[model samples]
Target: MSDRAAAFHALHRPGRPLLLPNAWDHASAAALAACGHSAIGTTSLGVAAASGKPDAAGATQDENRDLARRLRELPVLLTVDVEGGFSDDPAAVADYVAELAALGVVGVNLEDGRPDGSLAPTELAAAKIAAVKAAVPGLFVNARTDAWWLGVPEPRDEALRRARAYREAGADGLFVPGAPDDAVGLLAAQAGRPLNVLHRPGGPGLAELGRLGVARVSTGSLLFRAALGAALDVADAVRAGREADLPDVPAYGWVQELTERFRTDGHR
Candidate 1:
């Protein structure tokens, strides 16, 4: 097994789903890495928002590539979310995956559903998966299905069908971001491949997911949104003069000092 791939796999404890926290930029990733996160992924939503582009629209290709380059030096394993491979062309998708793999990224998340609320053809998506495997060979492809997220009825059946296809097409794992709670565990069992899922705050806890045999649990954009929410909450609390519930935030100087330390130590 690839050290990177093996590192990611080792995170999948038998009774615990690997908690994959996603980061938006270098500072966010470096900070998370400093917290001892062994593996990290990127959220396309955060990346797209930071770059002022619409997510899952094939935009911000260069920006995402640049972020991968910046994260290449990090000590943790890195996974990038390449929305629909950033193009419908399988060759283009393979090229993009190759670029990321060259930067030491061990994994990539590729969605099959388009931004227009339509799903990419199964054959076409599978082709992209196969091409990525051929190009990188070691880049873990987490094939994501938007059957439920896109409002498709009969999500379970549809997700299973597409997931099986992706696995056969050489995807290392299957991600059903909006799969039903009842079906999520079932998918993990039936997929026969590693199940990488999005964690909803109020949804099944990680322990429940591990019991269900989920191999990986991703905080897909949840942490990013939570950060935004926390900022808003703190501002509102300050305006209301509620000093007690300020969330015990760290001082700016502390964050700044960490920045200096990061630079001085050159630790990724």
Candidate 2:
């Protein structure tokens, strides 16, 4: 495995889960790295929305690739979220992930959720995971099942089935977003791989998730949505002639320094 890949894999300790924050663009990623985030992931919704396109419909392939290219220059590990691998064909999915690996990306999150809110066939998802691993063995593949996210009937049973299938097919980790807190330990114990859960506000924090045997906790699109909400809140406050109740807003120069350091040193 490459050094970056090894480092990323090492971060997924069962009792010390990695709190991975997802970023949308270069500024957000660099700023996160500046704040000492050793790894950063791209948010598909944020990428698509920023470009005025719909997310999870394979509309952000180019946008995702561009952002991945830009983020490779930062001093942090990167993992791109290729929704449904951007295609149904396993070979095509493998090729797309191989490209990201070539660009120095250490990991990727490939989900089974379709644009129509239906889950992909378990065999197809497993095929994609197997194909990706065969193409790039060193790249960490976080195989995501949307059973819970899609509100399917008996989600826990379906998630467990898919998780086992995915792991058997060479998935390095299992990501079941929107998993209920009580069921987390069950999934983690039986998934036979590192369990990754999405961070829900007002839900269990990182320490609690670690205790539940989760190896990775991703923010997913929460950060992006929160950022948009914060921007709108500031705008509304200013329009109403009220002081913006911003919290620890980054200075303009500080933001500029992120770009400046990249320009001068080529990386943080």
Candidate 3:
């Protein structure tokens, strides 16, 4: 494994979960790295929305690639969310991920949720995972099943079943987003790999998730949505002539300096 891939894999330790924040662009990623985030992921929704396209509909493959290229210059490990691998064909999915790996991405999140609100076949998902691992053995493949996210019947059973298949297919981690707090430990214990859960606000904190045997906790699109909401709230407050009640915002010069350093230094 490459050193970056090894470092990223080492971050997924049970009982000491890595809180991974997803960034939408170079500025957000550079800022996160500036704040000492050793690793950062790209949010598919954020990337698509920023490019005036839809998320999870295979509309942002090029956009994702471009973003990955930009983020490669940052001093942080990057894991991209390539929704459905941007294709159904296993070989195509593998090729796309291989390109990302070539650009220095250490990991990727490949989900089974389709754009039509239906889960892809379990075998197909497993095939994608297997293909990706075969193509880039060092790339950490976080195989995500949307049984819970899609509100399928008996999600726990479905998730576990899929988890077993993905594990057999060489998945490095199992991501069951929308799995409830009650079901986390069970999934973690039985998934046979590092368990990754999406972070839900007002839900169990990171410490609690670590105790539940979760190795990685991803913010997913939550940070992007929260950022949009905050921007709208600030705009509304300013329009209503009210002081924006917000945390300390980064100064304009600070952001410029952040990007400028990356531009000149190439990579930290």
Candidate 3 yields a Cα-based lDDT of 0.94
- 1-268: candidate 3 lDDT, tens digit per residue: 9999999999999889999999999888999999999999889999999999998899999999988888877899999999999899999999999999999999999999999999999999999999999999999999999998899999999999999999999999999999999999999999999999999989999999999999999998998898899999999999999998887799999998998877634554
C-alpha TM-scores of all predictions: 0.92, 0.97, 0.97
Clash pairs for candidate 2: none
What lDDT tens digits, residue by residue, belong to model 2 across residues 1-268?
A: 9999999999989878999999998888999999999999888999999999999998988898888877777899999999999989999999999999998999999999999999999999999999999999999999999998899999999999999899999999999998999999999999999999999999999999999999999999998999999999999999999999897999999999889875534545
In model 3, the Cα lDDT at residue 191 comes to 94
Tell me which residue pairs clash in candidate 1.
Answer: 75-268
lDDT of 1 by residue, 1-268 (tens): 4788777756766457889999998878878888899899999999999899988888979988999888776788999999899888899999988988888888999888998998898999999999999988877888999999998878888888998899999988889998878887789888868898889878999889999889899998987888788888888888888863556576798778657655524554
TM-score comparison, 1 vs 3, better candidate? 3
RMSDs, each prediction?
2.2, 1.6, 1.5
Select the stronger candidate by lDDT from 1 and 3. Answer: 3
Steric clashes per prediction: 1, 0, 0
Model 3 is weakest, by summed lDDT over 10 consecutive residues, at: 259-268
Q: Who wins the lDDT comparison? A: 3
Candidates 1 and 2 compared by TM-score, better number: 2
